[model samples]
Target: MARGAASERDGSLSDGVRPGEEPADAAPPALAIEGLSKRFGDGAASVLAVDDVGLTVERGSIVGLLGPNGAGKTTLIKCTLGIVLPDSGSVRVFGADVTDGRRAAYANVDAMLEGARNDYWRLTVRENLRYFATIAGVDPDSVRGRHDRLLDRLELTAKADTPVRELSRGMKQKVSLASVLAGGAELVFLDEPTLGLDVESSRTLRRELRRLAREEGLTIVLSSHDMDVVEDVCDRVVMMANGRIVADDTVAALRSGAGDVVRVVSADVDDAVVATLRERFDVRGVETDLGAVERDGDRRDGGDRRGPTAVEVAAGGDALYDLMDALRAAGVTVEGIETVRPELEDVFVDLTGVEPGEGGSDEGGSGEGDLSDAAADSRGRSP
Candidate 1:
């Protein structure tokens, strides 16, 4: 996880959970930031991206801004939505001060960040959610039943009169998430909302972004390379790399410190059973090819290399039960053992040694033009 090994630890933001609701221990911070930083092209091609980061984000939580590929998570989500501009920080939204002159702290704050080009390609998913809910000034007769409940909770109310370039790219990412929740936004900011979608439209836009944070309390801030959609729709995962924030908690406390895994599978997993399972546990990645034991048991080079091989390690649950009695006392015939459980893509490839959309190519360059210049800096400001 090079890129300056995440400047040795500095992540903090905790009071998270709010899925089926229950979070009100002094509720405040629906996005506070602090000491944030950014840099980009100057001397020796500048490039610091974002560092000294801090975060808060409570109020109906969903937060998961993981990293990799210039780990600044789109420049800390374009510096917490003021659309990049943080040489030092203190953003604050629910406590106001969005760099003062604050349009009412972003008037509820909405964002879609260009996936499916944040719609309007010849409008009509109910006219691009009533013209971005009138450029997010809202009051479309007071959200018109919250814009038909955000197009029937992103099922897109039968494609709401279709045409944002004839839908599909997961129906223009649910009409760019119903044009950012048709301005009923209580903090949204969803950059790669299920990137290219399809796995039942990325599980129906992550179950309508967990029903917009469990029964409409809102506040979601998800960036994604889809670590299974940030381990099934994030309940707190922060991560980042190089430009700081090395790991914020909960995704079951970073998959409980990523310790237990132990898959096996063997047409006699060789190399002396991987040097006796790396002299007893903590190995990590290996795969061999009895034609990938049904396509994902691993192994890749020209497959069908006569039968089995796959060994993953990392133990510690009584050293994985004494590494299954030391791989059956070193005889190794186990054609498959289990107990893996530790994902968020193995804690984002062990805290960002590059793997989610790995250093580039999950669409086009400059991370989709830096999320279309932060969704054109929230067009005319504040949404």
Candidate 2:
């Protein structure tokens, strides 16, 4: 079994249910949102940020929330956190309803939204954790052991005393993650946690989050534009587009649904061979290497450089064999050839009609919309 395979027993404490009142074997889902819809503004200017969204997250599982910009990803998160009151919907954390602004259910929940925006810039790394811990009603002394372990796992122990203002962006991000975990929250929501992080820092954080979910039985909901993070860490992916969920499935299942992509590269390819190749397969694009460009001397004066060193095409399984035969018959220098299996990005593009980060304008951008107005919303509320 995987390290973080979800346990059948629920790990959260539901305030609405008393001990022995409910069935001992049945555990409520970590999160349940039904008929959730939210719109920004009104009249003709109104933008439907979320449209009748329904989702359920199992206990002790890692779920990825993915979407292109202005796809209501942020709005959905706000609605789930009680930051933005939904026009119509029901939100239940564990078993306690939070649909109406009752945030007491959030006692077992914590969020790391807007990257390190929640961290106090002037406070030391340790101080930031302590502050949030206290505010979350966690006893610092009781959690001291768990807190130290979190620091070591996240590699923030060395800079425990360093002021947040002086740390690198990656380090500050880790501090923010530690703060969320320090409170011993059963469920954590992370929005773009790896947005600005370097490769190494991002890798470390993913590992830590997975460990928390596996060993500590923590339920995590992670939202990010970084496909690699979602593919590597999440057990299931819920993809949103045009303010609605278009697909919900595991990463492998989604990838399996895309067409097989084949990449062919050759230095000896010429215009006739290229044309023949395109005719044989559903050509996506051809990329010219410097050598290929040099071969086409007529293109030296910035004319049409038709021949290329590499070509990517989509082909059926049997057609793929014919493509190979056609290339060899044309005496093309087949330097490299392989089937490029679909990745999470391919699935995302196929479902959303646009690539991640390429957003459709309804509402929300870098500096506009409710997401940009972080000040208007508190930890769980977005104005």
Most accurate candidate by TM-score: 2
Q: Which stretches in model 1 have alpha-carbon errors above 4 Å?
A: 1-27, 31-130, 135-162, 169-171, 181-186, 189-227, 231-253, 256-258, 263-314, 317-325, 328-341, 345-383
Query: Local distance difference test, per candidate?
Result: 0.70, 0.76
lDDT of 2 by residue, 113-222 (tens): 66336677788988877776776665567667777888898889999998988998878888878987777778888878886789998999999888777766688999
Q: How accurate is candidate 2 locally (lDDT)?
A: 0.76
The candidate that achieves the highest lDDT relative to the unseen native structure: 2
* C-alpha TM-score for every candidate: 0.33, 0.80
Clashing pairs in 2: 83-380, 83-381, 83-382
lDDT (10s digit) by residue, model 1, range 1-383: 00110111111122344345455666577888888887776787577877788889887679888777777777777667766677887888777778884566776677776442666677678877676667665545556676787787667788788687876676787777777777566777887787767788788789878866776568798887767787788788888887788889889878878777878777767888788778756788787664545335654443435667778888766887788788778777676677787777877788778777767422223565755655554553222
Q: Candidate 1 at 336: error in angstroms?
A: 14
Model 2 spans > 4 angstroms off:
1-24, 265-281, 289-308, 321-336, 360-369, 372-377, 380-383
Worst 10 residues of 1 by lDDT: 1-10
